[model samples]
Target: MDMSERELHETFLPPFKATVDEGVASFMTAFNDLNGVPCTGNQYLFKEILRDRWGFGGMVVTDYTAIMEMVAHGFAKDLKHAAELAIDAGIDMDMISEAFVTHLKELVEEGDVSEEQIDVAVSRILEMKFLLGLFDDPFRYFDAERQQEVVMNPEHLKTAREAAQRSIVLLKNEGNVLPLDKNTSKRVALIGPFVKERESLNGEWAIKGDRNKSVTLLEGLEEKYDGSRVEFTYAQGTTLPLIDRSTQKVSVTEVPDRRGFAEAVNVARNSDVIMVAMGENYHWSGEAASRTDITLPGNQRELLKELKKTGKPIVLVLFNGRPLDLSWEEENVDAIVEAWYPGMMSGHAVADILSGDYNPSAKLVMTFPRNVGQIPIFYNMKNTGRPFDAEHPADYRSSYIDSPNTPLFPFGYGLSYTTFEYANAKISSDKFQSGSSLTASVEVTNTGDLDGEEVVQLYLRDRVGSVVRPVKELKGFEKIHLKAGETKTVEFSIDEEMLKMYNIDMEWVAEPGEFDLWIATSSADESNHLEFSLVE
Candidate 1:
């Protein structure tokens, strides 16, 4: 599960790893109401899960619409009882369910709930209210408080800006026309309908965000230096595809026209460099979005080829959520930047990188395969009887014919403004006892024009096992900073359990055998392996 607030509480770890209090906490039978209603009106969910396992002593908020939905869950006598049971159960806030704000204290005085409990809940809520500055000033966050000033703060801009550049996947850089020297080209063409819109800029589930004020790529370029000298033209290559029927009760903005694609190609005809923006909209791939095909939308695939026909240096900025099928763009475009909805003002973030205000260091979080056929492929998984081998053909092995066994872009792949070299790997002890520790060390050097950082990864592979282990497991990793020509040694200490494998019965065990320890820059990169033996 992701590191969300809710997940930080509900999802329990396997019992073998549970803490002392967690071990003591046991699941109980589903209970009905104290008399005739459901136990949701009961005070246990908050008293235990909140106060005990989670240590969430602050306050408990009813899930949205929960107090109102209590009549349906059949826990309360009415909205009144639902509100009463909730507050008595230590629920502190009513989030849109509205009833708790209406019927809490009356039930408390009726002796249904102890006044102390009400005070506890009220004190908790009021404390947060005070911390929010709601009680002290009530209007502090809104009144001349610089909401946009902070939202679009220089630091946030820098992060979004740096992230956009790093997440860019340089699929093909044929001529090296990139790192575009402003002196080299006076005129450039920024083409694409998405050059302005941000429906997909921050992707889906972006909380409390808007696009009307988002700085578009064109706007970013114009805002940068010498806007008067840099001759630039823009065209709508093609409109983002639509479903033909309005879904929003208040209709959303209309998509532009696709016929503009040919005109966009014409605009790029004589420019020194061409920057083409391509990809899906905000509603395209987050949350409920499940695409049957993850490819560039509309005629943009064909549009890329036409841009190539112009013979100008081309840089493609691709915006998408999941791994896209980019074989065509990878083949034709000079460079492809995979900008995954880089948040508000994502366009300005792009301009920051293109202008070389920041360096790229974002590694890919998921594998970008050549196509959709290789779906659900990830780095951390179990080893199969016969892992998919492309060189040596196999019938029963897990593989596909039309596609290669490997991802087009493997995991932990990212490029920086500089380069790094890895060497001199060593383990504290070539021999590690079952209960002892093993230290893996590697020296890394940054050999480039500018200072940069690299996330050196350490992986372990169990050669022969009672239960098969994956080809590699990321046992440890470290992010190190290095000067342009400096080197540093990184070491990872491995305890017995970190090197252990789970058996068929899910028992943690480490059998005496040859284990290969790897220290590499990335998962697919060549790693110097040292053989270590774990004794019984």
Candidate 2:
């Protein structure tokens, strides 16, 4: 948490504010302590920041065993005191701690805690129950017949497929190896540990999903070309350890079997195009599954190395819960599709994107590091006093001798079957009053051969401020669709509200200064640059 107050207000708090604006019901507090105070017992976070500043009227719940673990942080004397601190900090519910149920009553009787505080928590909890219509009919939502009708209905499945397609980010497409014609392919090799699996497709947190009903990649592709001439061959080249759900840990042995490597490479040599599905095992990511090695697990990358010898165009499809280090695959593979555990309809959605039925338009929300060493890389990072220079390399500059100071893929980065070009960026005025609105517009042209969508990103930077600001901050964005050779003008409105930031005095204000604005496809690129000013 090496961030200033301004950084917290500008970067970390926007998404939470957005959820509150959406009328979300409740919020679960984080586990880590802010500064020295445990988040579960931090009055500043729950009371001052969330309740008072943000006007979040919903209930606040602690994470699993968070209150009981306050003793580990040495902030609480014991379980009883921990319970009092948590309740007093505006936590309305304690999850799995039993700290409240055990000690809250005793604390109230001893005058260590007030009954009014308990009443407030109880009222918020009961209010949620009433909002969920539990009092009207407790068993209303438990109808087995209704569950059957809604679980995997055709319409519901279609929506899931569309969502999966939208979430799939096309990372790299060298030589246009994708958009493979299903009819033209004589033989297609679909090799990976995940090719035939069904459960992992639903990802973690899929509590009630029926894995048996979920379609595998092979099933979905076969369904697409059932009446056609394409044939699909698959091989599981490697295997990783399965996860223990009770402990939320992966169970892996010392030895890994690469027995199927020869078969997979053999299939690749004969096939017209090779589609390799490889990445983190379902349980290798997600909650309580942190890993020091963010690279591909097991012999999967080794399998890719062997497949590369065949010299066949490979479509690398990844299923991960977090951004992975793909420095090697980025250089070797022909195309990359990042589909992060694409739910029950994952296969169908991926097939749609790869087959060109759906042009990929989704962009990355997080930065993909070159390797594990570039752990905290992001697009909106500050311009250091000694920024790295490729042309003028020096020891004092902030850069790794082993790697460049850039991410493998920056945030908002994605590829489509088509391409877009940005030009003619214009601002409404060169100078504006402090509290006035300004418009930034740009022309986006789809110059490729197919219809596609482009996310026009608008980034701003205060040239100088009372306090240091990030090198670039995403102010606004618009997603627009354009047919081949189609041109569209996208516009964004910026006001005093967007320009305000917490200054050195800890007061939010907009300083009169020169500002740099950029319109681009991704945050990394400066497709168009314009200068504007705010006058006092």
Candidate 3:
């Protein structure tokens, strides 16, 4: 990506800076190149920004075969040159690449590389090993009995369940169709490809996890509601495409004999409510899983259309790794819950949300686009010269003729079983002076009958600057619990640090200008805001 220096520091580098601030122990270099330089061999990134400017003392490691891949990136002539470049760029470890092991010795002997550089890299690795107590006791982490005891202990599972519950985002709930009433909605139909799926529950990264231990959605629901009280029906509406990775060319094909659309519809027709689990299979995402179309894979969309014929309230429960194109589901489905691969406790956590045992408090960290056409969509985007106006449609403006410029769901957006209202937003001062801080506060009240947690978000916009700025940037957020009919005040401290950004000259500074601040629910929220100015 050809990122400008301003964009690199302001947008892309903040997260890495944050990790460095938090004192992360290690960092793995990216496989891709920035501009024309591969990250594994980019001196500007590893040496200048990460080490010199930020003072990140952590060991830097290359991604799997990333050091050797510099040849493919055309940044290096061969493995020896790639190894030399990576080491010179401050890479302390080479993952899955023997380039460093094989070529470093020869390069040093040939005077192409210095012995001191090798010593520095080895010292960093040894420092990390010492910190991990590997030198003190190399076999400390190899206790099989301890590993077996704590691998899936009850306490760990409980924490996993809670984490899974909090990670669930309630995207859309038309007419409050969610929190399925067990007493009223007796016959519940659990339909779709993932009804009893176990292998995909832990997602792509959980290679060591035992799939058999995972509790399926059907199993969780059955355990939550007794069979005597709430009758349950199950149907595999469709089967996911089988991915064969035995050869160099991966083949994805549908199970020839497992289509059960008719049976699923028949079951849905008899049930009062339908909980359809649909999304990409675990393998459809993660490494080497790039796709042009990020919609519900397989015949699942067709299956949903068939189930809609029953006229039952469909609660679409998503299980996937990345943001999906949920344009049709958002419009057609009664309710939508983004339960992104909730690990081993996926089923129990999802069931808790569905049964109203837990109110979802998790907000989306990433923006979900309405369609794949809006691939690079985000909340903190710079308002171009001809910004799109919803009130006044113009062909010259930056927008799509077919769809709105807005996303399906904005960043920091999540719904709750209970409703929240933001009121009385205020700033401690009208003008902020250098070295002094201001408090931005707002009153959040739980208006609904159920008690819930609300993530009060704080966003800021620099109206004018030497360089163009984002329309809004999230500065602070606080997740507070409010009881039914309770109101709580949430305050955020805003200092010059929060306002600092790379100027036109690429120097980090806070320019004196008019700024807009909002203490609201989500990035899309524009209801309550305060205008302030930074003075010289």
- Report the candidate with higher lDDT, 2 versus 3: 3
lDDT of 3 by residue, 272-340 (tens): 889999887788878888788888877788888888888999999999999999998998999999999
Per-prediction TM-score to the true structure, in the order listed: 0.75, 0.96, 0.97
Clashes in predicted model 2: 0
Q: Candidate 3, which segments miss by more than 4 Å at Cα? A: 246-252, 255-258
Looking at model 1, which ten-residue stretch has the lowest summed lDDT?
1-10
Ranking by lDDT: 3, 2, 1
Clashing pairs in 2: none
Candidate order by TM-score, decreasing, is 3, 2, 1
Cα lDDT, model 3, residue 109: 95
- lDDT score, candidate 2: 0.88
Instruction: State the displacement of the C-alpha of residue 131, model 1, in Å, after optimal TM-score superposition.
Output: 5.1
**What is model 3's C-alpha RMSD?**
1.5
Q: Which stretches of candidate 1 lie over 4 Å from their true place?
A: 1-94, 97-142, 145-172, 198-200, 225-231, 243-245, 248-258, 311-313, 462-469, 500-514
lDDT of 1 by residue, 347-394 (tens): 677776666555555666678878887777766556777777667787
Q: Which number leads on lDDT?
A: 3
